[model samples]
Structure formats: structure tokens, C-alpha cells
Target: MRAAVFTALCISLSAGAHVLLSANPLPLGMLAALSAGVFAVAFLLAGRRERGYWSIAALLVPLELAADTVFTTGQHTCYGQSGGPVAGSMRSLGLDLLCSGEFGTPLARMTARGEALAGTAASPWLLLGAHVGVGLVAAAWLRRGEAALAGLLRAAAAVAFRPLLLAVAIVTVAPVRSTGRPGRRSDRTRAARPRPHLLHSVLRRGPPCPAAA
Candidate 1:
């Protein structure tokens, strides 16, 4: 019942991306974005409700790929002026190799040429790859019912979904400066450091560890 409701909501949301999505007639990029969101949320809810993260995770792969493909495949033109559904999506997606915006957001931008309609800002492929990798791990975790494995997956997801979560947090609630949080005091000291010296050192050597003082 929960899964049903969850799936329904996804479909409803995606309908906007799909219906409004288009290069020529169909809004493929929008559709794909909507689909990705729906599947991601659906899988998460289903996993929790049925206690079958693996099952949901398995289905999540194709759903993600399909959403990615749909949005990517029709986003841009390959050899022509504009995309023709398939080619457009493909060309749009291929651009992601250079950048990483799956949902047409900023962090995904490498070149100013990346268009929002194309949904070429984020790397849907990277995201899809991570999902695939996690799914494999989930397979093993399910068999052993390892709570540790579950925790590991949760940690990975927390990190993986940080960008999305952060965006939501920032948009919905402005980022608040740390309130004397632990180690936060060092933030000011760190900021006051000589940038040139730090840059030269970093350039000469990789990230430094000053534990020895």
C-alpha cells in the first residue's frame, strides 16, 4: 500500500517533466528528471516499508538509467541544429562526460554552453553508476541481513545525496553560519592563513598534514 502510493506520487510528479518536457514535441529532459526523482523516492520508501532495500535497489538501476537516458538522449543535437528525440537526448547526455548536471543544476556546469533544458548540468551517469554499485552491495547486505552493511549503505547514501540534500536545505532554509561548533574556531584562523604560501606548498606537494607542527 505504501509502495503503491509512493509510485503514484512519482508518476504524478514525473508527468510534469514528461508533459512539459520537449525538444520538439516531447519534453524528454523534463520527463527523465521527473522519472529519476520518482524512482529514487519510490525505491527508498519501498525499501523501508517492505524492509526490502535490495529488491527496491535492483529495480532502481533500470529506472535511473531509463530516466537518465530519456532526459539525456533528447536534450541536444548531435550532428544537426536540434535533437530529434533520440539523438537530442543522446547528445545532451554525452555532454555530461564533460560536465555533471543531471537535474540541470549549477554544480554540474563545466561550460557555459550547457543548457538547462538539456538537463546537462549534472552527471546522471555518475549518479546512475553509484546507484548500480550500491545495488550490488545491497545484494550482499540483504542475504546476510547485516546491520553493519545497512549502516555502510546509509553512510554512502548520506554522502552521495549530500548535494541534493544540501540544495534543498539551502533553498528552503538559508545556510546558517556555524555557531561556535567544534573546530569551527579554526575556520577564522584558517581563513587568515597566507593564501600564496598555502597555494605554493599545495602546488609543490599534495594536501598537507601538519600534525607534527
Candidate 2:
């Protein structure tokens, strides 16, 4: 429960930040804008793991609205003319709610064309489906991806230790080739060579021993 609350708070803050930064006239880079969605999904997965597909389905709308509200608050957005005064400058629940009819958002405009909610034209229902579908797909994909992730980790470990393994193999084989065989042969030859005769040495000194008899 605490994990889920923390995840939700983080997701909301990130989403709000994205909204606030996107309104800046200066280009803030793509990651600054899209990072919220990426982080939100990551937090969702971390909080729920393989369970709670329903939570994702349920939270998508509220999250979107919350982000939209962040964008709308204190924002001055014009409808059509660029140089004209801002049309919807008052406090709003974002463009999705405040701007409509002639000043509608793209989705609202598309929906106003009598296009079916489930048709090729974009609508809230289509957006909802896409959002939920992506979340569900991500959950399913990650659930089944454990083996692949483990294999990748194993492969990385093997690559990291490859040089060490090569060094070990070289150490094991090099001594035998360079010195091992020659040292054994030298020992055998040294053992095989005849030693000086002990009897000959004694005989050379024996003439002095006969006087003792």
C-alpha cells in the first residue's frame, strides 16, 4: 500500500512537471517532455509488478486529466490567431475541457465531425483504449520477459570475464609447453647416469688396511 502511494505521488509529480516544462517557449528537449510517461509506466510496474492490470485501466483517465489541469492552470493559450489576445486565459481544467466548439482541441474538433468514437478519427474512447492497451501490453511483456532478462545478464557476465578466462587458460597451458616436459626429461637423465663406484674408492685405499690383520 505504501509502495503504491509513493508510486502514484511520483507519477503525478512527474506528469505535472512535464506539463509545466512543455509550456516554456524555449525548446526543452524531447526527453523533458516525454520522460513523464516513461517514468509513470516504470513506477506503475514497480508498484504493481505483474498484477493490477485493472489499476492501469482505471487510473489512465484521472492521470491524463490531472496532467491537463497542470497545463491549464495559469496558462494563456490562444485559439486561432497567433498575434491575437489569448482566448482561454482564465483558470481551466486544461485544453481538453476548457477549449471547445470553435476553439476545440484537435480531438474535440475531430469528434465534432460526426466521426464514430471507435472510427479512424481520434476520440477520447480511442485514446483510452490506446492508453490501457499499452499498459496491459507492457505488463504482459514484462511478466514473460524474466527469462530473457536473465539470459542477458548471464551473457553480460560471460563477456565481462572473458579476458580473465583467457588469461587462466594461457597460464595453465604455457608452463607445460615451455618448461614442464624438459624438466621431467632432465630429472630422468640425471637419475640414469652412473654414479662413481664405491668399491673402486675403497680398493684404492685398501693397502693400508692389511697391516691391521
Candidate 3:
């Protein structure tokens, strides 16, 4: 529960800082400093666990994607453009890709479409990269002697535990009985065996008790 709270707080502060830095008219240098401070505090409060950092990434990434969708649709509407939902979604995805620093003809096309918003001098790519970088660092730090990739995979699994558990439960079932019939039979066989005595072997005799009497 404490981990969850810490994760939530870190993600919330990071998301808020990103939005303020991107959409507000505040001084870039000051915003950057404040954002850095907030992130440092969040990191310290969240502890040195990979899950906390991955939790931050898991929450922040989706948020940025949603924000991109809203920003794209709002910008188009503001410009009196009539792009439908599909087009708007595509534009949003393209913008998200741009924010990830995946530059190419697709980004050029998006830029040509006049999707750029004012007061966004702070690049989304930089913000996302920084977030991911921090996550990687945290994962590395927590991994210790283990492989970084393994730690990252664990963090990813931890973040997606609910869905993973559901999938696993759907695909598998518990056994109806722990012990099989064969196991019970073996126990019975052991119990029914006669006990051996040291005197029986030494005093072995034929069935002539009546003749000896």
C-alpha cells in the first residue's frame, strides 16, 4: 500500500510538472529547475525500487498519450478544421511519436499539418526521455548483481500484474486432488506388510509341531 501511494505521488507530480512546463508561459529555466526538484523528491520518497520507477513510467506514458489526443483534437477544432475521430487519433499518435524523438517523414507530415502548439517550447520528447532514463537508472540501481534487462522485465511484469494474472488464470486451472489413487495404494501396501523378527530367522522350523508333541 505504501509502495502504491508512493508510485501514485511520483507519477502525479511528474505529470503535473510536464504539463506545466509544456503548456504554461512560465520561464523555461525556472520550470525546469522546479521539475527537477520535484522529480528528485519523488525519487527519494518512492525509495530505490525498480517497481516504483516503472510504476511512474507506466502511469506517465499513458497520460502523455491521452494528452496528445486531447491536444490534437483541440488544436484542430481551434483552427476550424473538421478532422474526424480517426484522423484526429492518427494525428495524436503521430504527435506522440514526435514527442518520443522518432523523427522522420511522419513527423514532417505532422508538422506540415500545423499541429504544433504555441507555448510548448519544452519538447515532449525530452520530457519522456528523461522519465524513461530515470526509470532505467532506478531499475539498474535496484538490480544490483542481476542483469539490468532481467530487472526491467520484472518491473514491467510488476506493472502489468493484474492483466498478466487474469491471462494466466484464464489459461490454467488448479488440480482437483493433490494425491492420486496410486499414492494411497502405496501407503496401504506398506502398512499391510508383516514385520520381521531377528528370532524368527534363527529359530526357523518346519511344520512338525504335532509330531514333536
Candidate 4:
């Protein structure tokens, strides 16, 4: 019961976030803008500038993933669900814009589309299936995209910011790279240096030679 209430509260808050976004677009926009900006700034400040380009490119991948998550969620919660009956489903469908955007949170999502009543979930699976179906179709269409820029953008996204694949790869490879230190300590240390952190602590001195000169 407590968990459900908490969930409902959270959903309500999320709904408010979307609805009230105009009240504070600055913060959200700033964060999003900064994520992209810092990625570029840090890259330029570093010697390995190419890495920066790739890192900035990689940032797009997450934003794409976020878009997919939002879109699918909206489709499921707002458009595709079955309600109490066909009539209810029809009514609920009418509320898509509000449900998908203004009230995109769980509490706002109806078990039925109507307020002041328990929402009837049309079919969670059905909603999920529709989302997946649309995703696959969109993916296929995207594959056949006509615009060169679109194709290039997609390709670059996949390479620099591949979602599921990139996430899993990072998790799997990070630990292995970190833990399985080499039989040869120096070489391994050198490899780890750039990836993890700078190694040397102190500055080298040539005071005697300078004094003699």
C-alpha cells in the first residue's frame, strides 16, 4: 500500500514536471545543453581531440535512447491501452496529448482514461507489443532513410552512442580492464593511466644542473 502510494506520488510529480515544464524549462534545458556543451569543451581542452569528437558524438546516443524510452512510454500509456470497454478505449484515446505529454506520469496514466475512477489498463502487454512493433517498423524505415544526412547521423549515432550495445559493452569491459591487471605491471600501469587516472605524483627536479650552469 505504501509502495503504491509512493509510486502514485512519484507519477504525479513526473506529470507535474511535464505540465509545469514551461515554468522551469531553463533548468532542464540547461542540463541538456550543458551535457552537450561540456562534452565539446572538455574535448577541445584535451590533447586527444579526436576522442572528444567521438565522446560528443556518443552523447547523442543517450539522448536518442531517452527519446525512444519517452516515445514508447507515451504510446503505451496514452494511445494503445484498452480501457473498461471499447467505448472507454475510444474516450481514453482522445486524451492522448494530455496523457502523453501533459500527464505522462504513471498516476496520470489511466487504468481507464477517465479521472476520479480507477483506470483500467487496456493491456500492458498489448501496449508494449504495439510500441515494439512501431519501433521495429521505424527502425526498418530508418534503415532505408533517403537523406544522406539522416543516414550519416544514424550511423554516427550507432557508432558513437549505441544504446543497449554500448551500455553493456561498457559494463562488461570496464571491470575486466580494471581488475585483470597484467603479469607485466609497468605495461598494464601505462595502459590504465590514460583510461583511469594520471599516475605520477611528483615533479622531477634538475636543480643541481641548473645551479652549475
Candidate 5:
């Protein structure tokens, strides 16, 4: 429990620092080093635990990616841009990448442009990759050693092999309700209802009120 808590704290601090210091490469580099070192220590702590640390370490990867997406987008809207729609339709691209890995290239390009303009910002791709590396390192260093790595791989495979699980995950993580059109009801309900026949409708209308009399 202590190790899990510490790991979560480290991840939060790392993500928050990245979002806050994204505009300063020097500080971002320093943060990178500091975060790596801290994660190493956290992994070492996980090594002392009996079980479940691997799962915690595994969680760090997606959590870090998600945090980067959320915090960076928020930072961009609040600090990088004026009061507006925020990156148009591509604001949550980072989190979006989780479900659709194809967006990785576009996201990298977008960040590369921003980084070029800022002249000090770190590439989000590199930053996130480094965080993922930290989590993998922690998993490898866990007390269970090879078993931990195997478990991680197995879990990943389970998700990868099952399309339903993937779809369910996308549904769970996506902002479906928020993005959907207002007042739209479920299609299933509409489909289940019995449709009125054209003859029945005509009869109900009583021959169109006798041709309007």
C-alpha cells in the first residue's frame, strides 16, 4: 500500500511538473531527470513488496499518458491560448491516442511544431515515452522479477487479443455522453418499439377528414 501510494504520488508530481514547466526546456530536462530518479526509487520500493506492485507499476504507464493529455490540454487552453474552443477538435488528442494509436504520428507532428515555436518545450512524445520507460523499469525491478514482467505482458496481451475489451475500454474512457448530440435517445429503444403500419395510420386519420370537407 505504501509503495502504491508513493508511486501514485510520484506520477502525479511528475505529470504536474511537466504540465507546469512545459515551456522551459532546462527545467523540463531537470524534471525529467528528477522524475526518473524518483521513479527508480519508487520501483525499488515496489521491489520490497510481495505482490500487486507489478500491477501498480503497470498502471503508471497509462496513468502518466492520460495525465499528460489532460493536464497539457488544460494548460494549453488556460495558458497557451486565449479564451476559446481550445485546439479546435484536437484538444484531447493525447487521451484519444490511447484508443486509436494511429493518432501518434499526428500528435507528434503537432507537438513538434509547438516545440519548435516555443524553442524550449520538450517533445511530448519523448516525455511520455520516458515516463513509460520508468514504469517498465519498475516492473522489471519488482520483487517477483520475471514473474512480474510476465504478468504485465499477459495482461497487455489479454487486452490486445480481445476486441470487445478494447471497445469497452474505449467506451469507458471516451467522453461519449458529453460529445453526443443533445436530447438524443438510444437507438435500441426506438428500434424495439412497434412501428405503425401505413394502412393503420390512414384508417386512424379517417380518410384525411373527408378531403377537408
Candidate 6:
């Protein structure tokens, strides 16, 4: 379940990036709302006891890709572009590759010159390859049983160690001393109480002396 949720989250982030890079970008508010919705669903799935929610990941991947493809194609068309949907999608994919350093200067030049049609035609295959590669890596990581919430928390803590340390320092420097002072008065009262005289009690409780008997 954790693995599935993680995969969905990764795909969602990739889709969000695609939206941001598209020629007609979505408003930041809309993107934020969409992301919040996705995350809320993912959070619910993560907390579920049953594994049925894992199936949603299977649906999210294709949905995300298709949405990105459609959005990119629409943006290109709306901008009075010369290329078709395939070319537009290809350019988007190329841009992604360029940003990620998977594609070199040649592809970047082609995209820059609006000559990315040929490359775009070949991009679907490349996109599939990239997805497969990422999936394999995620699978390997998940197979190690390292996809739990605890692992996520540890990763977050590791990444935010400096801030966490600062927070700890702040709390330590300004410790909240208890105002009620719970054990102090109790301790003084107990100390002031007179203890029983052991010897006196023993003699008083002793059986009548033999001489008195």
C-alpha cells in the first residue's frame, strides 16, 4: 500500500510539473487545489487497513499521462502552432528530458527551432522507456520493504535535519519549567511528618514482662 501511494505521489508530481511547463500553464491556485485533492486521497489510502486502495495507482499513472498529453496538445493548438498533438507532446517530453539532462544540446536545439516533430514522433517510446526505468527502480526500493510511513518520516527528517536541530535548540534553550511544581510541597510535608519511635512502639507492644506476669 505504501509503495502504491508513493508511486502515485511521484506520478502526480511529474504531472504537476508537466502542467507548469505546458505552453498554457494552469493557474497556481488550480494546481495547488489539484495537488491537495490528490494528496488527500493518497493520504486516506495510505491509512487504510485494506490493500484494495493500491489498485488506484494502476489507474492514476495512465490518467496522469493522458491528461498531460491532452493538455499539452490543447495548449499547442490554442497557440496557433504548426505541429499536431503528437509533435506537441513530443516537444513537451523533450523539454522534460532536456531539463533532466537526459537529452543533449542537439535535441534542445531542435526543440528551440520548432523542428521537434521527428523527435516528438519518437518520444512516446522514450517516454515509455523512462517510465519503465522509474517503475523498476521504485519496485526495487519497495521490495526491500522500505516504503512505510516510518521510512518516509526518516527521509524527511534527514532532509530537514538543520531545521529540526534548530527547533531542538530553541526548545532546549527555552525550557518550560512546570509552574505547579508537583513533587516539592509533597516532599517537604513527608519530611516534616514525625516518624514512629520504633523502640517505644516495640516496648509498648511487648508482651507483659515476666516479672509482671
Each candidate: what lDDT? 0.48, 0.43, 0.45, 0.38, 0.51, 0.48
Whose lDDT is greatest here?
Answer: 5
lDDT of 2 at 57: 36
C-alpha TM-scores of all predictions? 0.29, 0.31, 0.26, 0.21, 0.32, 0.35
Greater TM-score among 2 and 5 belongs to 5
**What digit string (tens of lDDT, one per residue) describes model 4 on residues 142-207?**
334323445576799888766878778888884444555446887767766756445555668756
Q: List the residue pairs that clash in candidate 3.
A: none
Over 1-213, each residue of candidate 6 has an lDDT whose tens digit, in order, gives 453456455555444434323222332333344455556655765554433323544544554555456444444443325532334664565533322211122323434423443236665565555454444554454434444655677788888897888888998896656648567888869867998777355444858889899
Ranking by TM-score: 6, 5, 2, 1, 3, 4
lDDT of 1: 0.48
Candidate 4's error at 115, in angstroms?
A: 7.6
Q: What is the lDDT of residue 188 in candidate 2?
A: 72
Residue lDDT tens for model 1, 1-213: 444444443343332233233222224345444655765666565554234556645654455445545544444432123532234465566633422223322222433432454455454454455546644554454435435556778899999999999888789986657757556668878975877645544345666688845
Error of 4 at 105 (Å): 13
Candidate 4: where are CA atoms >4 Å away?
A: 1-118, 146-213
Lowest summed lDDT over 10 consecutive residues: which window, candidate 2?
Answer: 22-31
Using alpha carbons, what is the TM-score of model 3?
Answer: 0.26
Instruction: Give a tens-digit lDDT track for model 5, residues 1-213.
Output: 444455556555455445333532112332344455556665674564355655756655665665566545544443344423324455465422222211123333434444454344456556666667766665545535545656787899988889987788998895634535554477657755888678354443435565677
lDDT of 1 at 147: 52
Candidate 2 lDDT over residue span 1-213, tens digit each: 323443444344433333333322211222234335645554655542333445543454455444444433323342222323234443253432333222122323333433333234454444445444444554444334544655687899999999999999998884533454555777879867998777355444535565686
The regions of model 1 sitting more than 4 angstroms off are 1-33, 36-49, 77-103, 110-128, 134-213
lDDT of 2: 0.43
